[model samples]
Target: MLRESPYPMVSVSEATALIMAHVQPLRSEEIDALTALGRVLASDVVSPEDIPDVPKSAMDGYALRAADGLAPRRIVGELTAGGTATVAIAPGEATRIMTGAPMPIGADAMIPVELTEERDGMLYIQRELKPGDYVHSVGQDVRRGQMVLAAGTALGAAEIGLLATLGITRIAAYRQPRVAVLATGDEVVEPGSERPGGAVRDSNRYALMAAIREAGCIPISLGIARDDIDVQRQAILQGLDQADVLITSGGVSMGTRDLIKPLLAELGTVHFGRIAFKPGKPTTFATIGDKLVFGLPGYPVSSLVSFEVFVRPALRALQGDATPFRPQIEVTLAEPVRPSPDRPEYQRIIVRYQEGRLLAVTTGSQSSSRLLSLRGANGLLLVPAGETTYPAGSTLPALLTGQLLL
Candidate 1:
């Protein structure tokens, strides 16, 4: 016999708040700076010394006093980058310097080689020069004891380059969370295994694994567990022991065989067992001794959608990201769509820029079991529960998932 779920269904916002309340950033660890790309800094990085501590030439030209304008000066010596200045310029004298070479003691400006002519060891300047022109003065780019990067800032290519320039080889960064995925059902089998009648290949495990990786978390596969309560409990226990977050699919509904909800309650606290959202109404969240557990629906589309709506943000929060949610933008619908009568829907859409406006079109069929609906989709259009049909050109807000199509 089917039994009703004991937990009341809550709105998406309520569920998100409850989950976030339990989530906290992980502890920091020292790691090599070269491997810190995409990791959030746990502490501020201050410059130990000023960038370009000495005055350097910004162009390959002659370095001389600005007072000697457009005058023929004797080129005493040549200065290349990484070579020390052997001769200093005096009045009516100049030195041939390359880009990034340290300026001599008496030189105050640089003229580009393109604007000067060299004849018989004499340099003739074509353009008038001014002091500090084409010269990188001391501490011009960065000052000493200045905060170059703040805590909670995500490291990128440019940030890594800056750290290299500042001689910062190691960094303190938040540890990436490890998520374990468990697929439960008696009718499920591995992809390579032969499928018998009434048996289906397991796709949720791989899909959830990919989604976890995309969220910047490490994914650990817990394999599939049978519908038996004892088997599911053992699997869940092992998963909790090995991972910081646990995600299970196919046993969270109200069916008699559905056992994840009861098991979670017994093992920990179930914050919310159901959401008032379509395609993922039975999604459940819980906390087990500082670890998080998410029980998602069995359908492929529903599982992925729930991950995007809930798990992704949680992972980001664990890494101390200030903006944990996906970016949301207003978009215009390209066709008519019928809203769910009882619950709000997250419809998969392909968003593109049409002329000057952002237009979105729904992937055909919006069915929870059709995983193809997510292919080439870049946004999730939020449709409110209503009896009326939303006609073409209706403007609504959507959560961005990927790059917008031009």
Candidate 2:
């Protein structure tokens, strides 16, 4: 029988719910539209006026009245893009218009240059043209008073272009959260430090920093914090002072060097200290004033999984993302695997599309310390508790970590 943990344990769903309940979207900031990529909009962007504002030509062709006879017509003055049409097309007359140019008066259609031949200053229509042919009507794309971009929409390249079309130089979006990453433990040293008798390089903090950046949060490194209680306390306070969210990797589990849990309880309310999940059962969450703090495992893979499961969603929620959680899908197991007895498991797996089905293949070893298991992994096989062995062809839900090869 396994020894009972002193800290109360909760399910993953409960832990996530509690964390999300305490999260509030960050305050909005006005940034230039060009720099708003990947930012969630705080307010709906309404169109001030019609895009294009007037009827424009969709092609470089002749703008002439469709009622004009098929006989040759005199080529009047030319109209280029962005220039107003000063000449009107009367009977037996056509205006050479370029793409995006406003249609000349008395012209209801455009005949593409390829469909007509021009010789001796006269144009002959070789194809039948109908009214309103090849003409982009005013407000065809967007109308005044329309919502160009809805609130909570993450701005991307297409959104930026649309905002530019709407004459929006700047946009109001939720501010990105600043995450402070602190590595703790007496045996842990900086990455460049020489490996003495019994010291391990601090890789968790650097990995957490990159993970925070990937989640769209600004990462602030708090360096390494020794296992001493006083040092850990001071580091936590400093991290809180400079960051909106503090992520400490190490010193949360039941061990002689674990000082983060007790220190957090003394400093702030530790909401929940344990979860019924493999690889990251000792994950802890707390709130110091308005800032959120996450205590993750020291093992590299555990830290990565904990951040992806808890911290990442919280960060996205702070940025007003509508879909904060990673997408989940059902996939078939390509091989047999044993499940974690009373706790759920997040086994990293490489997903492939085979015969129109998603196949899940486990990454080499599931050890929490093996960060390489996450390399090239795009999905996590979510094996629930209460099952021993799952054979191939068994269906289970999986959460996406990256792009799946489908």
RMSD per candidate (Å) reads: 2.0, 2.1
Q: Candidate 1's residue-wise lDDT over 103-132, tens digit each?
A: 997999989999889999999988888899
The Cα local distance difference test for each model comes to: 0.93, 0.91
lDDT of 2 by residue, 42-115 (tens): 99999999867878899998998887758788999899996755888898899899999998888889889999
After the best TM-score superposition of candidate 2, give how far the Cα of residue 311 lies from its true spot, in angstroms: 0.6
- Where is model 2 poorest over a 10-residue stretch in terms of lDDT? 1-10
Off by over 4 Å in 2: 1-3, 69-72, 83-85, 353-355
Q: Spell out the clash pairs found in candidate 2.
A: none
Indicate the residue-level lDDT of 160 in model 2: 96
Give the Å shift of residue 125 in candidate 1: 2.7
Q: How accurate is candidate 2 locally (lDDT)?
A: 0.91
